[model samples]
Target: MSAVRLISNHTLKLQPQRSSSQLFRRHASSSVAEGSFTARRGLYASLLLLSTGALAAYYFDSRAAIHRYVLTPVIRHILDAENGHKLAVRVLASGFAPRDTQSDDERLKVQLWEDELSNPIGLAAGFDKHGEAVDGLFNLGFSWVEIGSVTPKPQPGNARPRMFHLMDDTAVINRYGFPSDGHATVLARLRARFPIFYQEGSEPHASLRSNALLAVNLGKNKTSPVESADDFVSGIRAFGSYADVLVVNISSPNTPGLRALQSHALLEDLLGRVTHALDEIATSESNKSRRPKLVLKIAPDLDEAQVDDIAKAILQKSVDGVIVSNTTVRRPSTLTDANKAEAGGLSGPPLKPYSLATLRMLRARLPAAVPIIGCGGISSGADALEYAKAGATAVQIYTSFGYDGVGTCRRIKDELAEALSREGATWMETVQRASAELSLKPEDRSAHTSIAQLTKEAEELMRLVDELGERVGGADPSKDNSATESTGVLPVVSNGTERSDFVLFSMANARQWVILDRSDNAASPCIFATLAYEAIDQGAQVASSNSKGRTISGTLMYRRGQLLERIPRHAEASEKLYLDYKIKPTGDKDKKLIWAIA
Candidate 1:
């Protein structure tokens, strides 16, 4: 009985040990499985973080190849032309747009008016018609951001499908018809861009960037009379204080009868009123110190006569600058895209020839003082350089910006810098040289007599001035030490001393004259006559002649209380003169200075 009981106890103990061994093995297996799962989770988390960082880096880099190759293509494929534009503006306004991380090359710097731009590349007006994405566009490295074809009142523009993309041709056509958010809405957006501690005097640029500019493109409302200048005048009043330049848009083919304003008579009236309004704004207390420059935007479809007439109006009204062209209504044979049949202005590679032709024609007629901003189908640095060679002070792009995505500005700038370096010239230098070569000279006149005839007339006028000086100041005509025999013009002096009233002299060509005020308290020391001596001769009555056949009966008309000093005198004529002076008629109050024959 004792042996049987001991056997049962041993069997029970053995069973319990077996159970313990199995339990130990199960725990070890479970631990191993948990460790492997944890390692996989860690690997996945690390991969996720790495991928996120890489994406962020790519998105921020303006020159990232992925933008041009992947993102832009995807967006374009997903959205239609108008939708894509809207999305772009929204993205930019939302501050998610890619930025240009690189600093502009020294070769890209351009001096325009009173400001120096970081680069010559600029975004044209149509891209941000409502002024919603000024800062974002600037982020892409555009030195000039022109917002709006903003009308006096809000407009819905044409119907849907108004915008078309010709992918094959690399062009776009739109009939937006000056669709705008109106002057007030756009003005609010511009004002909101100002910083918390904004000071107008400290930052003079409307763009709010030191090396950039903001321009407002003014367009007329379709509901209003096409012949009236009221809308444009109102635009100047509304945005004049907020913009560096005010573009008068009279060229959009989308707007009915808008092109009519470019006619000779209509243009004259329009420019006259516009300049008057600008002057009023300039003289106002709010903008007395600084006023926005006035620029005229014209169409690409103008004929030679139309271009000539436009140039005449620009010179006659003293328009500050000119934008060479807007979009064209014509279609090129090279356009194979199905959307080519759409009726609207065409822009892109095809429009280059027309824009270039118009630019060359107008550039030849206008003086260099009037800068031309070329806008057309410029897709690369070579394209921009072509415009620069044709006398464009700066160039603006639209269709290319639409097709090429955010990296467009950076890419073009890089290409332009390389091209300029290869040529060993800066943009400004190139433009200056081109302009000097292409533009008309002061001596060119189909109606006026030859320079030799004018020179003879000037010499005769100088002899008359010598006799007049002798009669007035009682100084011998020949004994005056300041008289220049080579120039054949006598300097106005009192008893061989510089006179305080004014000094009058004729240029060797007799086409120009100079007036100097030597008074101790004179505000300006020099004043140049703008009208040619031939005009003076034709208008003035020859009252009589002195014993020496010298006549001093002509009248000199000049703007009153206006002074222009430090004119660089002609190098060949007078060594004493340090500067040349230019005088333009302000169309304001005039005072005549008359010298009578004795």
Candidate 2:
């Protein structure tokens, strides 16, 4: 849901960050005074240092002044969370909306449906745990939003610091373990958003807020033994009447015994019963005309066979949709925090590729029409498009929005729009087709470079061989087949203006370029994307278009946003080499990517 809060910790981080900045400022001032010339001047500098030290000491120890000063004003900016919380209790709060024109102010209506987003995008399960923030999150603009892992009895979740912000890490480690205020608490919150009350048998549900398309992520209680179906059913049953969609969460790494529920036999039984229950609910509501969509959020750490098993279970069970992944147990090679040794799954940039990999696998194995909500490490529009390209129908962003705030959503949407437009499509469906052609799986990543380069080389060689056979003829076998075949031609390089033997090639002493044999250094899941930051330096035009050839590898091309084939790496070599294309310099193409030159 939204960056899984550690909700209170959001304020906690801000306090510490301010103190760290002050400490640095004090250190800088004290160091400069060491070079002063005269005794009187030195004494004055000492006094200034003392003043700085007191401020530094006060700040580092705790934010006594900031809490008294800054927080009151900051909270005031959000129309006062205090007042907003009151609005939660008082359904008839004044000044919600609608003071504008109607009949006379007719305008041309553009029925623009959001490019049906197929990226790893969806709301985190708990952001609207009670469905309280659904409308608000939608107002901020997201393709889809998730609410709840709502429990029947309501849960307080794990204890404090259950959620921690690993800031320098650009990650969050949380053990929130499905804390929710319960079905009634959320239904009340959502009901308050509406102008009318909702009738649930004799009960009523309504809210002043109701703008978001909701997907309800459900889980078993910490107290409940995950082995049993009764616990899960209890939670899912309560929200059935109100939820727009229901997600069976069998993969929260934080929750004890959560992954155990992911076992195929256990999962099939659970899903079968759950879907059956929802099916009956839908049937009963046929008169009322509403049936909540059923979806599932699984873990990223799952292996291929495990994914296949789950996919099979989903199919056999007749379930609805699937969210590709949850947080990761494996930390990345890029993790900079020494404190990262602490327990809990790692989320954010390190999880993007892994999450996308799971998504691609699901798309390949699962039946079509089984909608997938993508989530993990999506911070920008390009990242969203990458998820879309990887076969996500829509994506959920938690970390980026957590760090960057609500503005991140609009930024991602705008950027994704730009990406779609660049693909020569004004509509999202077209972009999705383009992305489907480009999606790559994780196992396909290793040979990305060699496969791409060799393919381009092979194409050039084939073209030349065709010309040679026609020119020389079979009568002069040496001049014909033997000439180019027996002796390989050196590739012609193109300089800025035209083709040449020597194009300016530079050697890079880049530290990151060193690829090690062991898993220790390359542990970062994003090592591929990290290397891709240097893709331009290799002077190649890379485009991901899903295609098939025995020699071509999938992993390499997918990183460039091209997923031409679903086939894994070839065990045997073939004449048709598949890989990224290395572009020769030409003034027109060379100028397009400025970074490629230097």
Candidate 3:
């Protein structure tokens, strides 16, 4: 009886339980009349039908809106809506011209050809001069790719049909100038599809993200030449944060007076400002643990003074890197791009030597610590080897990538690896070493070494002076010049009545020296003859010290007769020697000795 009673009560409570949210709400108004009692029921059914239709309409409308805005743009880009395919076609055509098509056997033979044949190749900035098909170039296999001379503003570049494909020469003549998609748009596209290296066992991305190494080249759209430095700095700041490396492209011949920025004052000012900006970004990024490299892409035609000045600036500002040799306005005596006669920088076969020369030249100007990424005129492995051997830290190929297909990078990597193994060096070490051996042609090497050379030479000269002193009793004590002014000094003498000699030694590298005055102490055996530089007390005790607080052990090399007689009757009387030192103030903390002046 209790169980039956509980069941009845639970059923009663379960009547029509109300929902937390809107559900079974009462109608706001009654429906219009239909015909009779049956008509009223029919009207209620009609209302339900209308409500369902209204809700379905709203859903379709919302979906349509989403499709129109969000989905369309992304799809359009993926589909190459902005004529993006042309970029691929152009890059393919420009990079691997002449051989619009190549046989498999010929492709296989390229790597064995040599460094001068391929490695570091060229892609003149304005080639795509418009931000078209960078993706296509990557697919063809370039170790690295450079795209755009993107400006702060959009530009159409020179004129229509400014790009000329020279079939015979296997090169393209582009006076397209620097067409750009502006800073914001291109950068946004690049960000969304940011490239990643598709290596073995690498983390995956959303879809077909690029595996190629990226370098985004920014250029001045149309220079207000007076504000050149400001333009470059702005370019650097705009794209400087996200790129793997930022290139300050003051070397483009297309922009008026752009090359003049290569002048010492202008170049230094520009590079100094740009690198400082890169560093600030680097520091902020380091906290996040990522930073872009800064590199300057210079022209091939710069004179030695210009190149030296650029190197001097790099050393002064401590720039991240440099890229040698861009396309040349100077035409080579060749026949590939007969239209090459058109007024534009000549690239392809003729540009190879010039580009390589620039690499060798820039290598000489920059310090070993500073890396040079050699580009331009490389169409084969031989070309790559030349750039590698010429002293580039890494090489980027553009034009040849277009011709070669995606296999280019793989082939070049294999060839470069072989070259490195044959030479018994790692890739980087190979460049540095091979560069030392390259007999730079006049065009490739700079003749000037002002600031850097002067500083190093002066230091070496000072070391020689010190070396000469030990051999011939020190530089005439009269020559107290500004030579030691820069670094700290320990004064040995100040009092007018007597002068004390002092030597403060610093060991930064290897050096050699031999003490003179052998006749002064014939009985004393050679204590540190093989020392080569720093004298060692082979078998002597530190008995006493002279001035300047440096204690050294040596038998009497000079002394009075009485002092010598104290040693042995047979010993020379004029022998005298003393470990050098000076009395120190009790307050100083780092002193090693406490010899008192007696």
Candidate whose TM-score is highest: 1
Give lDDT per model, in order. 0.73, 0.51, 0.48
Give TM-scores for every candidate, taking all chains together and pairing residue i with residue i: 0.73, 0.53, 0.52
Rank candidates by lDDT, best first: 1, 2, 3
What shift in Å separates residue 468 of candidate 3 from its native position after superposition? 35
Q: What is the lDDT of candidate 2?
A: 0.51
Worst 10 residues of 3 by lDDT: 589-598
**Which of 2 and 3 is ahead in TM-score?**
2
Q: What is candidate 3's local distance difference test score? A: 0.48
Error of 2 at 588 (Å): 56
Q: Model 3, residue 63: displacement in angstroms?
A: 44
Candidate with the larger TM-score of 1 and 3: 1
Per-residue alpha-carbon lDDT of candidate 3 for residues 513-534, written as tens digits (9 for 90 to 100): 1121111121211111111111
